[model samples]
Target: MTKSDFYRLCGGTFFVLVSNARKPIQSKAECYNGITSGLTEPEALLALAKTVIPDIPKPMNSEMKTLKDNTRDFKACLSNGGGFFRFGDQAVLKSFDVRVRQDYKQPLAAMNDFMDEFLDIKTSTKKDEYLVKGLVELLDADKEIGNDEIFYVRADGSTMTKSQILTASELCVQPFLLGLWHYVLTVVRDNKVGKDTYKDFCPPRGGAERIYTKQLGENSKREIAITYCDIDKTDNDFTEPKEHIPGENEENRAYKENDTSSANEEAASVPGTVINNNPFFLNISGGNNSIYNHVDKVEINHEARRDKGE
Candidate 1:
């Protein structure tokens, strides 16, 4: 079976086998919750598996027997030196009774061949360097966002401790690792610094038109026209007013007139005062005595403008 298929079918069994040897009994509700929600502890998961499948046995076949017997040894090899060694290969392969072909020159090679053939487990030539890199990336991304204090969130929305993630990394749990990698990428992408060029290709073709004009040259008249047409077709097209409220037009005109008169009066009172028709622009003028001299900046409320259909 493929690695994913094997894990899918027998992940619980493998967890029990590689976990603490003594299996505990769990309540029916706990078992159901553990299996369904995927938030239970490994020990609880093992307990639940046993409670559901009491007839589960070790040594069901030669392949299983080899895997069951050698997994601990393999784990030990990794724990001792953080990698497989030539000397430890024989001990790791002791459970596999198959004879190594004469063409194979080394014990490590023979062990790798048997493990791959029987258990779908391949020995990495890099000695877990890639796994370490993945773990480091995950941790770094977490730290970058000040999430180092928080537990890692799994794909199931359950939280995993740092130690749990580390253990899973060591065991090379494919699903967990894939989820963690995806999370790390998301974190990195979210916290990434720089302009988002992808949005230029999205809707609201103003940015796209500018990019196209700049890159393809202003001589491309047809493309520019097409870009303009696309922009006009969008929902943001404001060429014509969509709605008319009763007395709304008159109210706005009156407000603008009053605001202009107030501005004109204020300007008359202050020396060296300048006025601009655009409410969004600040009415700045020379002389420290001007009323606007105290105003460092002006801000426009776009939400209010949108509400008023400006």
Candidate 2:
């Protein structure tokens, strides 16, 4: 049977096989939680098969015998570093095969791609406020800002360590969601990174999106928060005018008017500031100041150069 078929019939049981060599624990045909405290990996496999087909031995024929004989071999392969032990599902196997073949410099690159897809497909349905809050919890930038740490790494090699990126005045905070998504995806997909990490690495997109996203978000909030913070600080002096109080008069209004005019002038004169409602200049800040520089244009006259052959 194919690996996917094996998983479908056997659940993802690993421990039961190794633990119980003689008395194979019968699986109640339940979805494998990837846990087998009292059971061995082989037993878990048996449990998984039973879950899929009540009378697995009768239907599976000689396959059941083959599984029983390979119990020791499976345990050994897993104990030794033989890469991930995959079973059940062609798409899952194919996706992993492709991921393995791709040359990724970053340790978490494949996981990040998976996560980006997950976020693009699943998290898009969430409300703006929920997404914003979810991002804050997931990245932990605010907490990390207080401690002064690197927030998260981008695929481009840049890091979001400072409180500035978290601020609305600086990078607008949304772009960093991509980074957080990458981090969570890696942690969840790799069994080495998490307990039962390999479990549900490629769950059905529509059927399990909410449950998976929520789990990943909740699990990753504290770690991400340690690296990033949302400060929203800006250098602009503009402030909203206060409402008139009982003692306030036209004199107060005149002062407020003057302040507004001066602030406008200051904002206009700021170097590298974009004109007329363009958001592109929003990236210009202390960290990115050096990126903007003037290049001198020299006008060369071709007629002024005489041919040496002449």
Candidate 3:
């Protein structure tokens, strides 16, 4: 009865509502793979909810963070081997409810991967490696490189095609993390981990001390599962369409506001390459302890339905 909402839009664009809808589907096989992995309905919800960073809903003014806003903080940190502290309210929600936790180390590792993704940039759709660091290698007299074709945006004032974006994302690939995802699925197969620990599989939010760190070394392997976020299927009791394609509903795509034509046009004139630096570290401050309010809400709904014999 506590329906999770997925918002989409007109342009072919999307974003995951990690608070309610976490698993955004990126491929067809990943869809079927999610079903066969023995993930129960609640298990799936718990898995998705783990990434639900507690914040109200979002900024009252839907005014988005410009590229400057998005990259400035991270860029500043990146200057001195990215040294600094992040202490601020999460901008997602309306009010500063939960204290934001900042893990400096995690973002540092992710930055290394982020820079790697910029290299060996390939056509996102194709498996071939297209050399992402071409522009960096050019080392023109100009210190900052202009928008290279390898960037996710397009040179023609349009967004990069889906395939192009995929190719560019490879620059983010951390060989240390290579096949780390596939291993997680196998761990779930062996029951080494349950949905509760699923979030740990991806990047640093999973926990402290990155798996790629000296801790993991050669013998370190873990369970990982790829979750698909079907816009309509927040709770699994509902029947899934034969094909669980994303964006089926244009009006309710997850994070649909990601489209940035205005930003793209304005950024074309701007110079300097900005490394992506979204921090996923845990918040030290404690507030509304229960990110699982949705879980309680679901129980209330179930009780109400039973009273009505629904």
Best by lDDT: 2
Task: Give the candidate order by descending lDDT.
Answer: 2, 1, 3
Give lDDT tens digits, candidate 3, residues 136-196. Answer: 1111211222334222222121233323433342333322121111111111112211211
Give candidate 1's TM-score: 0.19
How many residue-pair clashes does candidate 3 contain? 24
- Model 1 alpha-carbon miss at residue 304, Å: 95
Full-model lDDT, candidate 2: 0.33
Q: Which candidate, 2 or 3, has the higher TM-score?
A: 2
Instruction: Flag regions of model 3 displaced more than 4 Å.
Output: 1-60, 65-105, 108-131, 138-310
lDDT of each: 0.30, 0.33, 0.23
Q: Backbone clashes in each candidate structure, one number apiece?
A: 0, 30, 24
User: Model 1, 1-310: lDDT tens per residue?
Assistant: 3211211101222222222222233567977777443222322322222212222232334444444334333222221111212112334223211211221112223222222222212233321233333333324323333433333223222446554543443332332332342232222322112112212211245544211111111112221110000011112111322345659889999898898788777676654445556544453222222334344233334455556676
Which structure is stronger by lDDT: 1 or 3?
A: 1
Candidate 2, 1-310: lDDT as tens digits: 3222212101111221112222333365542755444344444444322211222342145455555545433332222112222333344434433332342122233323222222222233333233344444323322212424443444343556535334423232233443443232222222232213123322345654211223323333232222223323222232324555545677787787797677657667755443332222223322223332332211223333433332
